[model samples]
Target: MEGLTAQAAIVEAPGGEFTLAAVTIDPPGPEQVRVAIHACGVCHTDMVMRDGGLPIPFPVVLGHEGAGVVEAVGSAVEGIAPGDHVLLSFHSCGRCTACGDHQPGYCDEFVPRNFLGARTVGEGDIRRDGSAVGGNIFGQSAFATSALAHADNVVPIDPALPLALLAPLGCGIQTGAGTVMETLRLQPGQSIAVFGGGAVGLAAVMAARILGASRIAVLDLHPARLDLARDLGATETADAIERLSGPFDHIVDTTGVPALVERAIDLLAPRGTLALVGAYPPGGAISIDPAAVMSVGRRVVGVVEGGIDPRRFIPRLIDHYRAGELPLEKLVRTYRFAEIERAFAASSEGSVVKPVLVMPAVS
Candidate 1:
């Protein structure tokens, strides 16, 4: 393989220390694939990992929304080869109940393994040398210039597409689309209230549109996001979703802020459903009015990666992107890899919807 001059962002300490440095990547072991990352979407979860929300191994590589080309593959890997374009998702054990059922997003061992940043394969831990660093962040420490991901988890893409856009498709977009289509199963004309018009919220808006929701309302405080929300397909835009008073048939909450979650529950109409698609810090909990939920026969559900099977979802996304539907281009704003900290700042401030950090081309 070409000389691997991989770069990575290291979380040396919680909230206070994020360091970008050169790192050496090892060759893929059995069943692993090495990917030369072209783009990685700066996701909130990565930031949370830096800020110590998920208690990952220190100096961990933190990114899950990465798209790139396969540079190498291990002996046991099949159906994937060098030069294949791929996107990585949250890790899963293939034999688990959820994974066997094609819902790896629901794998029972998902949280501990993916969050702890442990290796899904290989003899010993891979790191930046000497220090105890963890790889396998989501089974693909994709924040680096390259990553070694489990081959089974890599979804191939046509090289004709830009890796920059495909990055977000891995998690954010898939989660939003899958939540409405697979998890909630919105009938032809049911209403959906989408809370928090960030990347995921706006994505839900588009996905609900694709599902033909009768009424799709986007709720968020940011005017710009609301504008984007409307562009995506939200029939109505609301700054305060709770102002609607009665709940709609479904609520998709992208804001893990407990207060907003509580408000979402309040807005549910009888027999309404709520889906929490965002990440809350460890120990984060929302207070619920059990009687209110019971009286209305309401249900609150959690969705991970939009409850999607990435292999199927990614290809569908590619088709949608080519078909003039999905409208994903409107969601992304790109930045250079060196500007990742700036990109993260813009994302955290809600100044940009989805700030993708593009890597420099290798010679």
Candidate 2:
């Protein structure tokens, strides 16, 4: 069968710059769909992978937070059709026990399905110069004008909403909001301290406020991010956690810094929980006082993808946005496809909370 050729950003080596190139994408499989990507969000995870934080193979295409319109559907796909708008998320093996329990974040095949840079069953669906290329990073190598996505990993959204603005909801935004509303389950009138004022931290702040948290504190090194946090509903903002008194009902550490994790543990109130949602470097470790844990009845948990099913959670986030609660657009900044490097630079410098790459509209 004939293939579709499109523009994509490819990294040829660890810590290499992303270069634009023409790549060929095969037609959808029996259970896949083709998306004409409109926009994709720049994420810290992509940065990490680019810098060799993960053992990703070189010459790979890496992007996950994608939103676009359906171009075609596989013979077996259902409920999704051409002309529908959708957001792409992480992939999971539906047969795994974790996936059966609705916790695809912990799916047994997660590493193979999401981190391997190729689909589980096929050699790969992307090629360059008649050679195979990595395509299915997170089931949607969305740094291109088009991508092939599994039916299960695509979530339909309203076409009326800005596609570029909705891109981040697939990962970063959902991870933050879900950590606050789903993982920690912060109740109204409770307290929470988020130890980072970036996209994830600010998302938590919005969710905490929506849940009526009486006191929501945010700590970040950047004054601008702290100010943005305040505007996003943080009741307290500080340059350091030391400036904020905690003993909070819940403490969330979105910074993987070992020192910050220790401090977050110390700030948790008796019987309170500390949720860790940050990505740590390989083999990194943190020390905690075991006696304090026993005496205070504290709970420490590591959260993955906010412990939420994207199909259920993304819609709720959109609903919150519609209700004027999420205000996710405040954190977004758009860049043209050719400006992907500039977008990466802004994200690396902490200049933009979320940088979305907008592809040229396909006519």
* TM-score top scorer: 2
Question: Model 2: runs farther than 4 Å from truth?
Answer: 122-124
Error of 1 at 35 (Å): 0.2
**Could you give candidate 1's per-residue lDDT for residues 1-363 as a string of tens digits?**
433557887777778545788887877888788889899898888778888888687767778898999998988889999999899887888888899999998898787668887564452345566454777888887878888888667999888888897789988888888888888888878899988888788878887888788889988889998888888888888787546545588999888878888878777778889998878656877888899899979999989988888988788877877887787789899998878788889999999989998888866
Q: Give the clashing pairs for model 2.
A: none
**lDDT for each candidate structure:** 0.82, 0.89
Instruction: Give the worst 10-residue stretch by lDDT in candidate 2.
Output: 115-124
Against the true structure, candidate 2 has what lDDT? 0.89
lDDT of 2 by residue, 29-142 (tens): 888889999999999999998888886767988889999999888888899999999999998888888888887888888887787874655423888999987768888899
Question: What lDDT is obtained when candidate 1 is compared to the true structure?
Answer: 0.82
Q: Score candidate 1 by TM-score against the native.
A: 0.94
CA RMSD (A), model 1? 1.9
| Total clashes for model 1 | 4
